[model samples]
Each structure stands twice: as structure tokens, then as C-alpha cells.
Target: MSRVRTLEEIPLRKFHWQMFFYTGGGAFIDGYIIGIIAVALAVLQPQFDMSLTLVGMIAMATYVGMFFGGIIGGYLTDIIGRKTMFLLDLGLFVLASIPQFFVTDPAQLIIWRFILGFAVGADNPISATYMAEFAPSKQRGVLLGGLIALWYVGYGASYLVGYWLLALGDDSWRWMLTSSAIPAIILLFARLKMPESPLWLASKGKVKEANAIIQKIFGKGVILSESFEYKEKTSFMDIFKNGYGKWTLFIALFWTLQVAPAFAIATYIPQVLGEFGFADGNMEYLGSAIMSLFYLVGLLPAIYLVDKIGRRPVLIWPFLVSSVVLVVLGITSSWQMSFALTITLFVIYGIFNTSMNIHQWIYPNELFPTKIRGTAVGFGTGVSRIGASLSTFLFPLILSKYGLEVTMYCCAALFFVGFLISFMMAPETRNMTLAETSTLNKPSIKFSSKPSPKRETV
Candidate 1:
């Protein structure tokens, strides 16, 4: 049999594109789903007589489903295999999304949305882990960053189509929601023929099988490393037992702090613009689509610099910029702000917030090893969803009671706090291999034997 191999040692090849495209498709689905809400809520609020509370809940429903879905998917992907959950989650997305078009009531739509969220939750961990594990070590950050960048592309696509459909009159929301299913369908067929993760196979002691797969990736004559050893099963507690616990803490604090504000802004961009008097015609949708482009553009520098510079600097500096500009934007909100001024600040904030947020996608995959990578990613991503769900649910309430300035101020606060955490705690993960990261020391953490809460860690 050919010698066994480590994932990092493999040569980067054209084959990586298949994995990237497949996973990127899933990321696109996530973006399209989140972005569709901009138009869906606008149409629904008038059509269904949607109260702010109901509107919040309808949006919250998907996050709620995703929270559990990410957690459950972690276990399933880790225990079963990457390819199974990889393909399966896309199928669930298709099934759940299709029902959205036919819903006559909020309750029905909520159920379908929840189901769709669950699929999104599952897809996040599985896709992120797959990309990290298979990528050449030097290119890992770039590969992972690009995977998330596709989310912005997907978000942009939703706006282009949503605005066009919105002009179609009453059935606009249905087409907007249903159109997301097309990408998921395309992803499903693409992923069906993809290979299993070799790192995961090695973790299961399938050395011979892993090598055979690597041959296809690195060409037939290559010899491989045999250093990896496998355990038959994973202990959920192990992820928390060592320094891994601190990494888990970072993911929770870092991801939630970013997502709560980022998503809230994205979800309500059209409405926020409406409040600023861009209310009539497709200008709001058109403006929303234009702004989405900045987020995608923001990802370009991050894709180039995330590995080149370092994760902490890229992550922290952007948050500082995002937070400071947010304060300026908030103060200007009451200064009789001109539309040009407001859009300018939002453009700057959008770029920084999106670029900084790429770290969340890159870190979870880098922090854990093959054995627990899925579970860890799923759990950490799930925790972040709690913050996302809460912020989305509470956004309207906060916006209504406190108005735009306070809402922007609160968003600024979250980013500022995240900046401190990242500056103090974000490890230099940019150029490190997954194995190197898994063994890196923590900055200083308080640990206890009190098996952490189920929701807190794996």
C-alpha cells in the first residue's frame, strides 16, 4: 500500500477548485437566504400585516433552526463522515426552501424557514472544515476566506434578483424566496460526486483508503507521510479538556460580537434606507444591491491579506475602523445628516465589518483537528447563531424604541468590545497548519473540571 499522508503536505492543484466551488455554493446559499429577507420582509409587512414582533420572529425562526442544526450537524458529520453531511445538508436546504413559495400563513413560512436555517447551520461547519482540511497549508486561509466571500456574492445576487422580482407586484416575495432553491440544487448535484475528506479518513485509521484518495489529489507516484494515528471515536469532552477550550471561547465571543450587528444591519438595510427617505420605487432595493457590492469588495483585501499579514491584525484593525466609523455615523444620524454623508459612512462600515467577519469562517476550521473539527465548528458556529438570532429578533424592538442613532451606537459598542477581545486574545493563526494551531498555547485562561455546559462547548 502507498504511504499515509498529512493534508498539509499535499500539493495544491486544480482539484481544489471542485471542493471550493462545491463549498462556495453552500456559502452562496447562506448569503442568498440572509439577503432575501431584505425584500421578503418589505413585501410581507404590508401583505400579511406583519407586526414588528412577528417580523422579528419570522426572521428569528431561521436562526433558531440553524442554532440546533449546527450543533446536531457537528455530531453527525464528525461521527459519520464529511461527504455524507456535505451532500445531505444541501438536500435539506432544497426541501425546506421549496415550501417557502407555497406558504399561506406566517406559521407555515416560519416552519419552512426554520428547516432551511437548520440546513444552513449544518452546511457552515461541514463546508468550512472540508475546505480547510483539503487545502494546501500555505493557501488554507485564502481558500477559507474565499469560501466565505462567496456569501457576499450570494447576498449580492439576491438583491439583483429580488429588486427585479419586487417590481413584479404581489408574487415578488414568493419568487425571491423560491429562487434561492436554484443554487442549492446546483450545489447538491456538484457535491454528489465529490470525494470524502482524507484527513477525516486518516483520523478514523483508514490510512490505506486515505492514501488512495490522496493519490488522486497529488498524482499516483507520490509518497506520503504516515504520522497520523486514529482513534475509533471522539470524546466530546476532549474538545474542552485542553487548551482547545480557550479557542472555543474565542470563537463564541468573536463570532457573536461580529454577527449580531453585521446581520442586523444587512437584514434591515432596505428599511434603514427607507427611514432615511429612500422609500419610493426600486431605489431602496437598488441602493441595497449597490451597498452589498461594497461588502464583497471588502472581502478582496481580506482574501489577499488574511494569510499574508496575520489574523489578529486583520481582524482587530477592521473592527476598530468599523467601531469608530459607526460612532461617527450614529452622531451624524441626528446632525441632520445628508443622504450622501450617511451612505458614505455606511459604505466604509460595510467594508470593514465584512472583511473582519471573514476570520470567523477561517478560525473554526483552523482551531480544531480532524477528529473533532466538525463538532467543534458546528458548536462554535451554533453559539454565534444564538447571538445572531437574538440580535435579529430584538433588532426591530431596539430600533423602534431607541431609534437609528442608538441602534448604530449599540452596534458600535459590540464591535469595540470585539476589538479588545481580538487584540488581547486572537492567536496568530494565519500561516499555521491545522496541526500547528491545535497545539498552540492559550494566552491565559481559567479552566475548571466542571464539564462545561452542553451549549457552551461540544
Candidate 2:
């Protein structure tokens, strides 16, 4: 058997691409559903006669559901299995989306949006964990980064769908919201055919099943004996007990920093545009389309650079540049200057934000041991959603009370804070095996009970 200790030794093969498509498709659906809501709000506002604050509340409600869903999904993924959680999330998305087409009241729309958000949140932690586990160590960055890029494609598609539906008239909003269900349904069938995670199976004491799946993907006669080991059944506290407490805290903070400014900027894009003399009607829609296009364009380079440049540099540099852009955007009040600054900041935001997005999903899975990977990822992501939920309310209020320039400056400052936190907390996991990556930050734990036989030393 080969004794490979570093990520550089893992060979690339066809199986990784197969896993990428399945996981990426799941992320794509998430982006589609979430993006559709943003566009739908634009279409629905005139019909409902709602204020911007109320609209922001509708978006916030979704994140509130997502916050709970992420926690539940993470724990369930570890206990039940990756494939099962993945398939179930798709099912929830389909159920929630169908009723949205028929909703007449703002309350009904908010309720359905929250339900859909819960499903999207559940899918995120599971998909990120499953994709990282299946990928070879050397290619984890690219494979995972590509999955993020696919999500932008999903986001862009929503904008295009909204544009076409708007051209068709008011009835089109129903079509745009309900149309998201089709992709969820397609992903449901595709997920059913995909294999369970071999690593997850092995962690669960189902060694024989794990080996069978691994061999199927890696081909017959591939040795698995070295990889198989008895593992203790893990609980939520295992995250803190097994040298992971500090890392977990850091990751949670990292996610909060990312989510705060990102949601703040995104939730108020149309309002910000309108403040600068852009009309509140189709002009807002056109501006959003432009921003979405810029976001999609930014994702391409992130896919190419994530593995080559390392996670820390890619994630950090963008926030620093974005901080500058946000400040500049805040200072400019003229319509022409605002347009130039908005486009520039968003393009920068898209590039940097997409880079950070790649790491947020990929890093937590790699940072924790296989025993507690899902739990850590779920909790970290859940915390981030809470930050996003708060930003939904906070940004608009900040803009209302303090005005646009102060709000933009606050967002810029938040990016700097995120940069500092990440610099101190996040370790570089580039080109490292999951096992090696987990060891980068050691934790101090006090075990209440004696170690079980299943808890083998690394």
C-alpha cells in the first residue's frame, strides 16, 4: 500500500468530476431559489404595496428558518448519513416552493419563503461536507470552488428568468417563483442515484459498505484496508471535546464576518440604487441584473485561483480591496459617480465575496476530524445565517437612520474587521489532506469519560 501523507500525492481521476456535478447541482438549486426570491420581491412589491422594510423582513424570515435548519441538518447529516440528508433537503425545497405560486398575502408569501429557506440551508452543509469528503485532497479546492461557481450560474439564471417574466407582465412573478421547483425536482432524482459518502460510511462502523462504494468509484482491486478503522459514534459535544473547540469558535466568527456585510449589501442594493436617482421600477431590475452578471463574472477567476493561490490569500485580499471600494462608494453622491462606484464595488464585491463563499463552505468540513465534520460545518454555517438574518433588518434601519453614506462606510468597516478576524483565525488548508488539515489547530479538551477502543490515536 502507498503511504501518502500529503495532498500532492493523490491522483486525479474521472470519479471526482462525477461527484462535483451532483454536489454542484445541489448548490445550483440553492442559488436559484434564493436569487428568485430577491427578483420576486421586485416583481411583487408593486402588487402588494409593501414598504422596503417589510420586504427586507420577508427576506430576513427565510434566514431565520435557515438558522434553525442548518443546526438540525448538520446534526442529522452526521447521524443519518450524507446521501439521506441531501435527498430529504431537495424534497423539502420542492414542497415549500409549490405553494409559493398560489400565495396572495404578504404573510403567506413570508411563510413559504421561510420554509424554502430552511430547505436551502439544510442542503448547504450536507452538500459542502459530501463534496469535500468525496474529492481527492489535491483537487479539493478546485472541485469545491467549481461547485460555488455553479451556484452563480444558478443565481444568474434566476435574474434572466425574472427579466423574461417581467416582460410577460404581473402574472410572470408566479411563474418565476414556481419555476424554481423544476430544478429541485431534477436534483431530487439525480441525488437518489448517487452513492453515499464512503468516508461517512466508514465513520459509522459500516466498513464493508464503505469499501464497496470506494471500490466502485476507484475501481476494483484498489486497497481499502488501510483506510478502514473503527470510529466512536460522535455527538455534538465531540466538536469541543476532541481538540476542535478553538477552531470551531474561529470558524463560526469567520462565517459571521462574511455574512454580515454580504447580506447588508445585497439586501439593500435596489434601495441604494434608487437613492442615487435610479428609478424604482424596471431600472432597479436592470441594475440588479447588471450586478448579478458581475457576480457571475467574478466567480470564474475564483475557480481558477482558489487552489493555486491558497484559501487565506484569496479570501483576505478581496475583503481588503472591497473595503476600499465600499468607502469610495459611500462618499460618492452624484448619480453618475454613484453608478460608476456601485458597479465597481459590486464587481469587486462579487469577486471577493465569491472567493470567501468558496472557503466558507469548504473550510469547516476540512477543519474538523471526520468524526465531527458535519456538526462543525452545520453549526458554523448556522451562525452565519443568524448574522445574515440580522443584517437583513439592520442594513435598512442603518440606511434609514444614518443615511446611505454612513451605511456604506459601515459595511466597508465590517469588511476590514472580517479581514483581521480571518487573518488571526483561519489557517491555510491548501494542498492538505483532511486528516492533516484537522491537525493544524490543536484544541485542549477535558474528557469526562475514558477513551473507547473505537477512539484510535491519529
Candidate 3:
């Protein structure tokens, strides 16, 4: 007789890779949509004769929409199911994206951008949860890490596309804004054939249905993980109970610290590079595109290190190094160093800063249980955007008023604070099953396939 394997123990298979591609596809759209706006804002400012405040409003609009989307979409994913929200958001992505090409005013553009941001926000939690629930424990880090990796790839592609589109005359920003729909449509159709998360099904006490999916997708030999047998009603409030609140706080803060500076900087990278004398009409966009490449390159090492050295170290060290790099970059800018030297410093900062991208998708899903995983991830996503939105809105204004040195110094301080927090709060989830990581305080717990009414302590 053959040994039976749990879903968490299954070896690498084609279907697993397919899932990775499909889920990570949403991440690509998220990155492209977010990054392309940086380029669009440059054109929009000159075209519309917009004030600085209005420019900031247009830049920060998506993040504002994300704030609400993260909270609502996450709760809905937990209540309704992952696959439902997963598809719905992509549909929204397609519908909301097309209108940008036709917008005659900032208000129209902001409304559509907000809807697009909402879709990205909703997809963030759902995609992470779906990937986590199915991935084998040994490959989980790399798999989740790949999702973030794809995000950078998409981010980089946006700049490349934006740079290329600059040649299409003054109306190129319209095309750049509308370009995201292509991938969103592709991913939407690709995901249609994918099934619901079996772990989610098992959590809802649909064992037969869950098993059928497992057998169909992963072969008849694989079984659902025993932990999912403990069916419990998931409530948004559950994220705050059973010692999970600390994790909720930590994940939210860490994500915020990472993205606030990163997003703000990336959103205005062209302008920032211009400050250092790279200000030629399209030269800054080209520089921004190259810097985006370093962001993708940075993720390559982290994909391996995340599983090898443990999540805690991977989370903690990058914050320290990136903080120092930003400070150096600030001083270099103050000294009016050669453009090459400044660019080298910016590249270094970009690489080290990107190490945290992996954790953005990894930590939220790993830290919470199936019952409220979406809600927890969504809460983190929503909260993080608040900081990202504010910083992105303020970045250009600050850069104009305080100069590049102060902006870099302020960002460095934020990075240093992140280092301290992660050093204190980051957990090591290496080689641990979802069951182990979710209930960090109760490592010895197990579950039977039999139904239960009591709430699981995750």
C-alpha cells in the first residue's frame, strides 16, 4: 500500500505552478496599475495646468480606494469565499481601467482609479490566502515569495511601458493608464478554470467537496490537512481575539513602514531622479525604469533566504541595511555628488528596500488562521494603504519644500523604525506548517476530521 499524503505534504506538481501563475497574475496587475500612475502624473500635471494639491490628490486616489476595498473585500472573502471575490475584483479591474482613457477631468480619473485600487486591495488578501492554503509547507515561502517577485516584475514592466508610451505624443498617459486592462483580462479568464481553496472548503465542513477538489487537482492520493477539520465561525472581530491582535498590529505596522516610503518614492521616482540632475524630458522615466529592475533583482536572493535563514532574519536585516543606505543617499545628495555616485546609491537603496516585498504577501497569510486569514490580511492591507496614501500625497510637496536631502533623511528614519519593530516582533515561520504558524502560542495542537462547534484558538 502507498503512504497517504496530506495536502500540505504534496510534492511539487504542475497544478501548483499553474496556481502560482494565476494568483501571481493579479499581483502583476496591481504593480502595473500602481507604478504606471507615476509616469501619468508627470504628463497630467503639465497637460491640465494642475496645482500641487490637485496633483497629489490624483496620485493618492487609488490608495484611498484601496483603504475601503481592503476592509470590505477581506471581510467578504472570509464570509462568502475566496474564489468569488477573487474573480469579482478582476472584473472590476477591467471595467474601471478602461474609463481612464476617456476621462476629461481629474474627478473622473480619481473615481476610476479608486475603483481600480479597490480591486487591487481586494485581490491582495484573497490571492495570498488562496496561495497559502494550497502550497506545501516546504515550498510555501518560495511560492508566496514568487507572488511578490511577480509584483516587481510588473512594476518594472510598467515603467518600461510608460517609457515607451512617452513617444506616442501628449496623450500617451491615457494609453498608459488604460494598459493595465490587458493583463487584468488575461488573468480573469485564466482564473475561471481554477477551483475554490480546498482548505477553505474543509474549514466550512464541506469535507467531501474539499476532498474532491484535492483528488481532482492533486491526485487521489492526497488528503486535506487535519487542521481544517476544526470548523469555526470566522468573524472580523476574531482577528483581535486569542492573542492574534498583537500579530494584527505587527503585520499592519510592518507593511505600512515598508510601503509608505517605497510607494511614495516609486510613485515619484522620475521627479526624484530629476532633482539629482537626471531631469531631461524622458531621461528620468528611463532612470526610474532601470531602478525598477534593481527592485526585481533584489527579490531573487530573498526567495531563497526567506526559507533558509528564517522569516525573522529576512524581515529584520533588510530594514537596517536599507535605512543606512537611505541616510547615505541623503548625505550624497546634500554634497551634490556626481550623478553616477547618486544613481549608485539610489540603486543600492532600491535593492535592499525590496527585500520586504516578499514578506508583504507572506506574513499576513502565515500569521492568521483560515477562518479569518482574509480579514487579517485585508486589515493589514487597508491600514498600510493609509500610510502609503498619505506619504505619496505629501512626497512631492515635501521634496519641493524641504529639498531632496530632507526627504531622504525622513525616509531613512522610517526605515530605521521599521528595523527596530521587526527585530522585536517578527516571527520565524521557516519549515512550519500553516497550523503551526497560525497558532504561534499553541504549537502542539491537532485536529480531527470530525466536526466541532467551538472556535479554534488561532
Model 3, total clashes: 0
How big is the positional error of residue 152 in model 1, measured in Å on the Cα after superposition?
0.7
Candidate maximizing TM-score:
3
Instruction: Give each model a TM-score.
Output: 0.93, 0.91, 0.95
**Ranked candidates, highest lDDT first:** 3, 1, 2
Candidate number of the best lDDT:
3
Encode model 1's per-residue lDDT on 125-233: one tens digit a residue. Answer: 8888888878876788788889889988999889888988977788789989988889888888888888888788878878778879978767664433333446557
Regions more than 4 Å wrong, model 1:
1-6, 221-226, 442-458
For 285-311, candidate 3 gives per-residue lDDT tens digits of 888888898877778888889988778
Q: Rate the local accuracy (lDDT) of all candidates.
A: 0.82, 0.76, 0.87
Candidate 3 clashes between residue pairs 3 or more apart in a chain or in different chains:
none
What is the model-wide C-alpha lDDT for candidate 3?
Answer: 0.87
Overall local distance difference test of candidate 2: 0.76
Error of 1 at 390 (Å): 0.8
- After TM-score superposition, the amount by which residue 170's alpha carbon in candidate 2 deviates from its true location, in angstroms, is 2.5
Q: Residue 75 of model 1: what lDDT?
A: 73
